[model samples]
Target: MKAVLFKVGLVLCVLLSACSNSVDDSIDPETADDDLEGPISRPTSGYGVDGVYKVAELSFPNTEYPGTQVTIFYPQGTTSGRPTIFYAHPYGGEDKEYNRGLFEFIAKKGYVVVFVPYPTTDISIDHRYLTLWTGFTKAATDYPNIIDTKKVGFMGHSFGGGASIGLAYKAFTEKGWGQDGRLLFTMAPWYSYQISPAQLLNFPSNTKMVVQVYDEDKFNDHRLAIDIFKNIGIANAEKDFYYLKSSTVANYRYGTDHNLPNSRSAYDAYDYYGVYRILDALMDYSFNGNEAGKNIALGNGSTAQVTMPGYKNELMAPLEVTDNPSPKYTQSKYLFPCSSQENPRIANCN
Candidate 1:
């Protein structure tokens, strides 16, 4: 595939709009029924070491059967409370292996991670929104001591990355962050989903971080993710995009058709470092309340240090095209709720 620049550009425009409007959200249908549902089913197999402990077969009560299940990876010994993160899996994947390596790495740094496995077979945006909100809320309330309810972070890959953005929107609009606030981080987000500009506009003005790993993914995902973040930044939205050139998060990027995965060595050396940088940034902001200052101290050099030829072209071409809208919000799964008969116009979700 040469590149899908135009589609990428269109996505940026849609997301920019979401940053401006207030999202209209209701109680996640899955959580409407009250019950302290337990964890989902455990993972059949995975690796965990030292401070890291992996627990699979955890289930959460949902509209679906056996409840929506997921996994948890965190430090083995935490004498005190630890920051909690709700980790969403990548799209088209059955488990959390897409982020397993990174999740375990973060766990060692002193944090609890809830690896959520959404019903991927039914990975519609709305379904994800409901599952994520319900699951996260359940974890916060049920495991208060383990999960610092006041400090929460969301990280996801691909479609899961997109879900992280939506979760941020919900957290902010619903005042879920009122006590201590929350952080939103997305890795290699699938920006093609058709959410409206109104729905996409709010994040830039709030707290968020998006990390894009450049590789050979179709839909020009890397460049498109950068374009989306740049628009948020230009709009003076509160967020930054950490760009990694030619370093796939895992060897699987190009190993498959998308060519986005990196080698195990690259994943450990480069990809893990990128995640470390982001986690450090987040920890500083949440604990120190000086994210901007921390970035300044670390120096922007580390933030955007990847040096790759043709990188500028890869970033600009797609941005140039996406600035204009084509597929539009109508194509996205986000349903702009209906209005009164007298006012047939439905307000944009932004």
Candidate 2:
């Protein structure tokens, strides 16, 4: 979880110079193969088809929120007006190396991504939200000409998933960022310190979201993802839920627990077919506006064939809304006694 902090003033200049730009600058998106029918196909297994864009990793200490650090993954020379994603790590997880493949995939797709790391000891969900906001604000300021701030996306896993919801809530209700377009993708979202279902209803109806759940998730359970999907008030057409089932037993270091999405080996069926493929499709649909990506995500026709063997998927076709369900809050074992008294700027801290 330890990151080497770099000087903020020199970050853009030094990091961009170090990065190698391999993307073809003249490829027009309107005529790109991504706009074709069926599922958007990948030319290779590991990397993306947008050619090579050098990956730049740099860390900067957040002055607004002390003890928080922002890590950026930028694809150098990806042309102007590229979409951006703000990523939040899971609780007690700090290393960007955990999801390096996924991050690289996103950057290679011509998007800027910023990962925010917060203190695990005196953690508060509001603090995590603020940390993400700081990261987004700083990234926008540093790469104004490169990033299209209007087309923003939020992604996270586990507790970070809950944090993504909180950040989106603020953007829609308070900050007005979602007025343009916003997309959210969360996996195995934990419910600790998340906003109420009513608060979620206030998000812009235009906001698109995808909730991913692991079938054998023991830590947070798949029901958490369902609950989040049910509470999201966006139009049924704008939201989708997926339940990912692993065909084979995971014998890796993290096993099948909640870490399946970030498993180190990309060759694994769950990581490659179940996790990465779905994520790539969602990003393509949301960021690139590819219809084929949407078809794949909705599990339409033979698109489910792209999933791993034995992977079961449920698409919210007739999207039913639940009536005023009682609030269910599952406290995290990592939760410690901390409040706004310690940090006045933390939202919703008691």
Candidate 3:
């Protein structure tokens, strides 16, 4: 009887100890949202992750350009004058699958996201540019309440990035778009055409622009991005030349390449901090007059903009930011060399 009682007591003690440890291991629900100093597996704060507003999607036929389509996402039953963003996709990225998460993220945040996909097959760059422009203008006119034309942003990737420059130029010169507030977020852009360096000077000094380049990018040379940064008329204060660096944590790695921005293929911390966080802050600063967002968006090497918190209390590599980027033009290893492209409009290629 004594032996049985001792065995039972040992079992009970083990169970009680496990229960106590379990409670200790569990995260405290109340303080879970606070910033953690130690190892973390996932992002705790969903800054630009999801927003208050519910997303409502609309697709307008490309009346101006028949073969294309324009998709717009906005907050459901929202008020008028929502800050609008015109997004152009990368080359061959003719479907919303390329950036649907980002589009929904913006729309849910009470902003309008206009995604205009241009033709890649059997179409010239000029045709693609025109198609995007016409589709954008049509969407704005059709949904006047949803899209606030006065406060606008032009964002794109690769070929679309290059086109954003020309499109912003046309919109500003002709329609006074962004006279209220304008921002340009270009990522891994190719050789820009349809606008000259002199014409680049035509951009409003107040316009805010961020030219993002990836260190691992081998398609578009950094010189291409640097040239645009130098020639753009926006003052050094408003325009930023941003460079993303690749990071690794143990066995995992975050890529800083041309495809890193594409949320569909691979989504990771870089997308949240490097791309979404930066752009979200930028839009807020440029559109809604949010002064605090300026520290994160165009901080120009400020700690808020450069710091990218990662897992395991690890600080991801800081983004290289500056007004003037002196890229080594001779050291380019881009797959599409400047000399190889036939487009004569790219200023630096020749």
Candidate 4:
């Protein structure tokens, strides 16, 4: 047992050290300690303000798992049974300022937005999974009045985006979540572990999911996003894979990279139209049974879901979506897989 422990510890140290060298921690706006990065101009056309409830937010220090902090943003008037969103963050993305805009926006739209940052420095990615689950379970257990376990959504960006898949499986199977409604959204996600192929075949079939990949993200391979989009057990009708393209409106360009969801403070048209619009519709369709939301959120091939609003309500770049293995991101183009990522999880190399 001692010798086995030593090998695992040695491998984890090497993994963390190597990964720390590979990533630019500052690429995402984790620098902000407080407040949203200025004001975001909300689009008045799509995704109306269905939820104008004043939001109340609180942060909790985890005495049990000291490395993580869990914060909850919920409608101020809610007493219980509110739909919830469980958000996971990428590595080194512990600061709330990284996604404060999204959190506040979702909260104002009337959902319990839970943000939990997992440890990215010393622990194995598997332990990081535990940290995420610990924080999530802690929040749900402590605030049963706020989190409606039956109706919940799991979403994340980059590293968190990939992790959201494995975590959502845990949420659905163990907790019996999604009995009412569930949604999973991944934005330029990373390689996810802690979930076996068998588990991938068992995700809730009714779950609404969108695996979003950016056109300009040169870091994480798009194949990784394709992996989850293909493997997850959901049917074609229930899930969609989005290839978000970049757009230039006037002199300012909206680049769809790995960090579009993070926005680092200054949000653009994509944040409002490309993302938040569909997400709002997805939530409404899943949780509230709003049938109109299906066209915009999971709109099979509708013009509205595929097109994003650009300059002066003109045409922006449309999203490329496919449920099958896409030739655009083919096996020949498969660059970074488990073999090259050097993730200590060993599952990657498989």
Over 4 Å off in model 1, which ranges? Answer: 1-68, 77-81, 178-181, 192-196, 204-206, 219-224, 231-238, 247-267, 290-293, 296-299, 302-350
Model 2 per-residue lDDT tens digits across residues 1-350: 11211221133223223322333753234422332111223344432243355555667887645765677776665547566778877655555666776676667656678787765433445665667677777777776666677777788887677678877777556656645567898877765344665777777776777777554455554445656676678766667676554333222221244565663433244454555566566666666677667655544323342433321332212221222222233323212111213222123321
Higher-lDDT candidate of 3 and 4: 3
Each model's lDDT comes to 0.45, 0.57, 0.74, 0.71
How high a TM-score does candidate 3 get?
0.84
Sorting all predicted structures by TM-score, with the top scorer first, yields 3, 4, 2, 1
Best by TM-score: 3
Model 3: residue 56 alpha-carbon error in angstroms: 1.1
Q: Higher lDDT: candidate 2 or 3? A: 3
RMSD of 2: 10.0
lDDT score of residue 196 within candidate 3: 76
TM-score of each: 0.58, 0.69, 0.84, 0.82
**Candidate 3 regions with alpha-carbon error over 4 angstroms:** 1-49, 63-68, 328-332, 340-350
Q: By lDDT, highest first, what's the ranking? A: 3, 4, 2, 1
lDDT of 3 by residue, 179-236 (tens): 8889999998876878877889778776888899898887677777777888788888
**Better model by lDDT: candidate 1 vs candidate 3:** 3
Of 1 and 3, the candidate ahead on TM-score is 3
Note each model's CA RMSD in angstroms. 14.1, 10.0, 16.2, 8.8
Better of 2 and 4 by lDDT: 4
Compared with the true structure, model 4 gives a TM-score of: 0.82
